[model samples]
Target: MTSPGRTERLVLPGVLTAEQAAHTVAAIAAEQRPDGAIPWFRGHHLDPWDHVEAAMALDAAGEHTRAEAAYRWLAAHQNSDGSWYAAYADGAADEPTDRGRETNFVAYAAVGVWHHYLATGDDAFLDRMWPTVYAAVEFVLQLQQPGGQIGWKREDPEDGGIDRTEALLTGCSSIHQALRCALAIAEHREEPQPDWELAVGLLGHAIRSHPERFADKSRYSMDWYYPVLGGAVTGAAAKERIEERWDDFVVPGLGVRCVLPNPWVTGGESCELALALWVMGESDRAVEILQWIQHLRAENGLYWTGYVFEDRAVWPEELTTWTAGSLLLAAAALGGDEATTAVFGGERLPVGLEPDCCTQP
Candidate 1:
């Protein structure tokens, strides 16, 4: 792991200094179990999506071995269907707290794996993780609706029965990035996956052109920026989407709101929005967003999950690894970290073949 004064690329003006970045990295590392599972915090539940997220941050901070261990943990605990349970109890022998398997959560392993491979250039690690990525992508694609949107989750753990009544804009947009990363891995190994290409193309179309296909969660900040962040909505459309929701979600001197009509600001959502802004070539605005959220950083370098401005207090009273993880990732992107930039920038990632039946938005 990077020592103090060595996290150069993780240093952003008002976001994280070199020493502060190292401390944050160490804080997240300290929370990881010997078995490599990273829960929300000690005695808290571990979700697969957030687990992958924290691991990606570890990689961004040059903690490659710890990141690899986190990935290995995922490979070991994955269910036979190529998915992981939505939640696992921390310090409870890896028992699942939630039996449901979410498609976006399952697909995120590919994003983390590809990020790690890019950061380390370890072909062996890529080879070891390819099957896991392949299985995960296959599992997620099984839940894809005919309209190119992904169903949120499988409610029945035994039979994998999906509700399929609604797809989430935020979740499907996230899966779009995962699909591209999965395709990149396959392409690296010279393994052609034509089906995945088609799947991704259709998913992108759905995200850009068919907002009506997803559940209506426009009140949340994630739905506003995730399409651009996830690479499904890009170029001029990406800027337009951000502009549409800018006033509704951003809170100026504070951070971003988790939901509208609420004075609550969350570190995770704020940092993610900064990442999306960076993707859209708005680094100045991204830096300012990161700056606004500095008030949420705790003394030990872990960040508070959120702050409720109306109450003028930190809600839930817990510091989270994922929140800190997001901060580091967004800072890395702004500071010109190559791997983080490439992953979020989406310029080099494979765009799966577009279906001729659906016109581009």
Candidate 2:
């Protein structure tokens, strides 16, 4: 049963009719290639992370065939080592000079596949994609450092070397959630993944113990809440992290800032923050954040990438597919949808880490 508020506002409400969402879904569907890949924007290159995001959006909007095609594209293009290239151009897998493999980007497929499976309850789809997801997680784990943080990427063209630095808090946090999902998938299949459990514990440790190991990225909202959002941290500490930064980045009726005092609040980050809040069991605050972005919607359901501090819009200057997708996922979480709830696992939050990393003065 859909909540009255969700039905009123997003479904039957005057803000966005079901027909409008259907049109938006069709527009997104039209962006996919004949091969089932969706590019970041029309006439732009496609990458794994954004492709999965767009695919999940399609799934959310009831375009399952297109979503499956998008996943098939990843499976077809996956490298022998269980990874995809950093980028592709003109639908060809050309190895660019800076073709460094991003660990977090590659691991994002697990979340997407699991999400699709939940939304559709397609066990066969889950079975078919399980190996691809398993291998991809293993590939990402190869880059994990001793401190439990995975390195940013491999093969930096500028440095002409592998950038084997300590784990980034944001990347590790995201990967931590991916590992948990991968493990759950393994369990569902009656398979064992001891390696995955080890990886999860290590990454959780890094998120809890190694704040100094991360790059100095305190200004970004990702660094502020991603650990909690990603299920790498939780409980009272997660709540404190949000409360501490609440006034710093949140502009009334504008949305959350990408960076503090930087005149740029983004829909993506704000929506993710709302999701994180939901993860921490604060549904009322999460709803408030989601509603704040309502003012930022364009004539179409699409949204600008970010809003300027002057209370103006900026960057890309066009509507984005992922922006709407993020909003939909956040809304689903807030409404206690079964698919969203199952993926997030009852909102108890992950219990393996402390949230004190960003609490320092």
Candidate 3:
């Protein structure tokens, strides 16, 4: 029933077979255009967040050049305000089908840039990327609401600018993690971005204390686990949060659902949840979560995006770059890769100045 993609490569020791991890890395790199742009797939569109995710996976696999190329592609295409359009055609196209700019999507560049630097220890690469990360962070913070929650997207002026200032809990949690990575980069470079430090603190506060400031997107799985995965939610609070929705988003053998009350299980969300569980120190459960999603694996070592259990079919029919990237990242985290542990587990990244003591630190 699975479609073949490519032969498996080197899998890791425990978390994944060397071949599995290698195939995932190769799948993503194989999809990169000559310009270093990696689409969701060969012919799909490239969004900054997923593009960064795939690039990070490439870095994990020691494909530093390809990863840097991906970042360069992003740098060359970035809008003047440090943002990228929501989507672009697979190649080096400058035009976007959607002109709206997303804060989380734009802000995630910092995470990838920092991760790439950590993986490669390339100071020059970091220097090249700091400006892009700085501009993107500045662009993201420009839309931060007074409540400290960031707006999801700045609507196109023609589409009603002020009316589109709404924010999302999942997106803010993601941005919260990105801000921490940005601060880490700042600290590593000795640039001392006080504003980014303050933003990181405030963003953590918003994620912890001001849930009301964000839109109610509880139906989605990312909303359930992202706070923990993003390092915004931790300790007893993170455990409590996961326990509260464990039944809602998880299926026994299928993996995490993309949404509640849905029979669809997605590879990305499931792998993300595995990473969250690893962060919580539940290695047994996290391993089980990864094992449960093996059904999504294809003969070629790539994975299907999601499966519809009710219909017993693979939906969307695409082996997306980010889905595999998420899986590799989660595996690397579990397999004790230093850079990955530092990036996702928040072990090495510097947490900047503390904000209002409204919640756990």
Candidate 4:
């Protein structure tokens, strides 16, 4: 890991000066309501997923108390099923309207909680969160199909119908990590969670062995890299996947596109691609991706969602929390900063489990 000072040196020049990054992070921390929930934009509603993502960013910035408070908000609001409702309007935790319980979103909390625990080594926080994580995984598993794909959601009345059992590589990949974290938490508590292991194996199998079982979502960069990002494949296979698709979405001096011919290069996808490259042991390429996004940072250290292909600066609209969070994570991975290293549990990229999806017949 880079020394704290060096890591700051690496990240400061391009995005924000180290001092400015710290101030910007602090400003984000201040956005959290007294109740501990951080909304996407000031006074905007807080969704479960983005709340956790922002909290993880706070944790990455070394604001552990704020991060814990964010988790506390989620804990206080958790439903009897150990899941949070899909959405909560600002200033209204007491009467959160459900967008209904989404399986993927609910399951993501485990991954976030585990990530926080890894960053801070806070055993008490881990203990408090384990039950919630386990329950959330169970709820999500109820929606899993025998063909190894998840049904996307279980509770929404409309579009809630099982869309397709074709496993979404991105969703399954995420669940693969969440299950591993949940299992680790289970083991940490010295509890037996056979079911959790089974869930992990099944999800891993779906991601590794069942590409055909998923929808052919080749247009998105996420579809190209998520299995690796989620830790479902590694070693030679990871290299092959990236090599095969390298040129399709990458735009020189710009960034990766969310989808081809979209003519819009997005910060979030670019950062994620950087992280994915890091996971594949391609540090130099990862740094290249980070450098590309460095050109897109705003003065406030925030990033826009996407830049138009024709004129990079034209559509600087829709500054996003996740865009900033993604850049922070990518910087942490590539620069090996103490703060990012501490929060991410390592300076190197995470090694996801080898799912059965990669197993040959």
Candidate 5:
């Protein structure tokens, strides 16, 4: 854990001082397992995507050694087929509690790897993680639907075999972003993956135009903002998409709601929406959105998962690393850090080839 004023690397400014951001990140760092595994919280579960998000925040804060340890835990635990189990008991990484291998969860490692490489300029580290990134992209693409949408997850063989379920817009959009990072990685290594480019293009088309293939998850905030955040859609179209749902997800003077009718203002969703706004070049609104969530922050710099504004109580009563992670990452983006900005702003990664067959008529 880094004390305030100790990070000589990150240039912290207005929204959160260097001390506050460093302290917030320290709370997340304290939860990293000796084997490098990062659970959601002290007693919560470990999911690959959120674990990688928290690890990326660690990288941004000059905690490179610890960040690599987190990646190493993934490298050490990844299944032979390249995907990790959907969830693991807090620190018991020996086996996943849920054996289902989620495509989005499996694919997120590339985002972390590329972000880390940008932060550190460590070619050897990139070389070391490339196979892990390579295998993960391979695994996620196997479930890509012919229409360009990706199925969510495959049940464990013993329970249901390698069956693909319904696709979720949010998940596919996330995988779209992951594919871009993976392609950038392939580009760096001079390994051509033509199939992946076509897959990305079609996947983007699916997210932008063909909402019919995905489950109706419109009630959730992520399904509203993720396509833009994931680079599947951008520019004026992206602005309109978010503006269309502004009132539905945001709670004035509080934060973004986790779900409608819940009265729960979550830190992660709010920070993510701020991130989306930043990518859309609405930094003013982005800053306002971020400011709305500051009430959710604690003195130690760790953040509560959500608040039941109706009851004036923090509902979950849990301080999640990913919650803290999202805030730090958003701050890094707002502060204009090149690497972190590149990750969130759709700038650093190369967009893959468009598939001829998948475009909407």
Candidate 6:
């Protein structure tokens, strides 16, 4: 278990004290299996993206060994094609509940690996994970559309080969961040990936200037904030983008709504919005957002997935490590945790090259 003092950096006045942060960190650590997989809960399934997020929280709280174990779990379970299935049974090694491979889910390993590297400064670990990251990036770029948007997922053939010819605004934005991290790793190892530079540059262009290429998920708060959070949109444009939808998704003291027309606010979305806000240099607003989501925290130190504001009840009745993870990470950023801040703030990350011919202006 990580010491309570290790989580001192996660202390935020209205959100968490060091003791409270330690409790939350321990709750997540307790759910982690001996093999290092962190499911949504004890009996739930694990998804690649959320698994990485939880591991990142552990790192933020100075749980390096546990974090490294989580990465090892990912490496052990990776498909020969460089992707993991969409869902896996929590306690079983070979039991995948869902066989479809999501582009963003596969790409997210890079973000987590890069974050762990930044947190621990482990060169040998980076070298060991390099091939994994490289393979995953190649798998994701295989799904990129000609217009520079990545197809959200490749459905299982058993599901009748459903034609999923659409891209998601949120997923592509996430992949944008992952691609940058992959390039950073490449640079550190003195191995140049010219193709990745082109891929990331074009993906960023699509995200910033051509939203029409992706599916319309604007009702979801992730679409509203992810481009900015992922570092593809910046400066006055990022601020303007956030302001345009601030009223639509934000539920005042309750936090961010999962979607429009639904009176439900989610801890994960709220924390992610806080992260995007922090990326834009709006730490005050970000901290305020994090403060508002404290209502979702359960007695167990984990958080409920969402609150139905209209029903005035906790919906889903499930506590998620990812929700708590997102909160800790946002708080870590606000608290000046260097690793969390560097990974998300992204000023030091490489921006892949966008050619003159592809310039938006």
- In order, how many clashes per candidate? 0, 0, 8, 4, 0, 0
Over 1-361, each residue of candidate 1 has an lDDT whose tens digit, in order, gives: 3597558889888788899999999999999998888989989999999999999999999999999999999999988989999999997588888888899999999999999999999999999999999999999999888899999988864666655547999999999999999999999999999999999999999998989999999999999999999999999999999998898999999999999889999999999999999999999999999999999999988999999998999987999999999999999899888888888999999988778888634
Per-residue lDDT of model 3, residues 148-200, tens digit only: 78888887655764435788988988998899899899888888888877777
Residue 296 of model 3 has an lDDT of: 89
lDDT of each: 0.92, 0.73, 0.84, 0.70, 0.87, 0.92
Cα error, candidate 1, residue 191 (Å): 0.4
Model 4, residue 22: distance off in Å is 1.2
Q: How far is candidate 3 from the true structure (C-alpha RMSD, Å)?
A: 3.5
Candidate 3 regions with alpha-carbon error over 4 angstroms: 1-15, 157-163, 356-361
- Candidate 6 structure quality by residue, lDDT tens digits, 210-237: 9899988888999999999999999999
TM-score of each: 0.98, 0.87, 0.93, 0.86, 0.96, 0.98
lDDT string, candidate 2, 160-243, tens digits: 746666567888888887777777778778898777777777788777667887887888889898988787667888888888
Q: Which lDDT tens digits does candidate 4 get at residues 175-250? A: 7666666766677678877766666666667776677777778898888888877777777988998889989989
What TM-score does prediction 4 earn? 0.86
Instruction: Estimate candidate 5's RMSD in Å.
Output: 1.7
- Each model's Cα RMSD: 1.3, 4.6, 3.5, 4.0, 1.7, 1.3
In angstroms, the error of model 4 at 290 is 1.3
Provide the clash count, candidate 2: 0
Model 2 CA lDDT for position 249: 81
What clash pairs does model 4 have?
208-357, 208-358, 209-357, 231-352
Give the clashing pairs for model 5: none
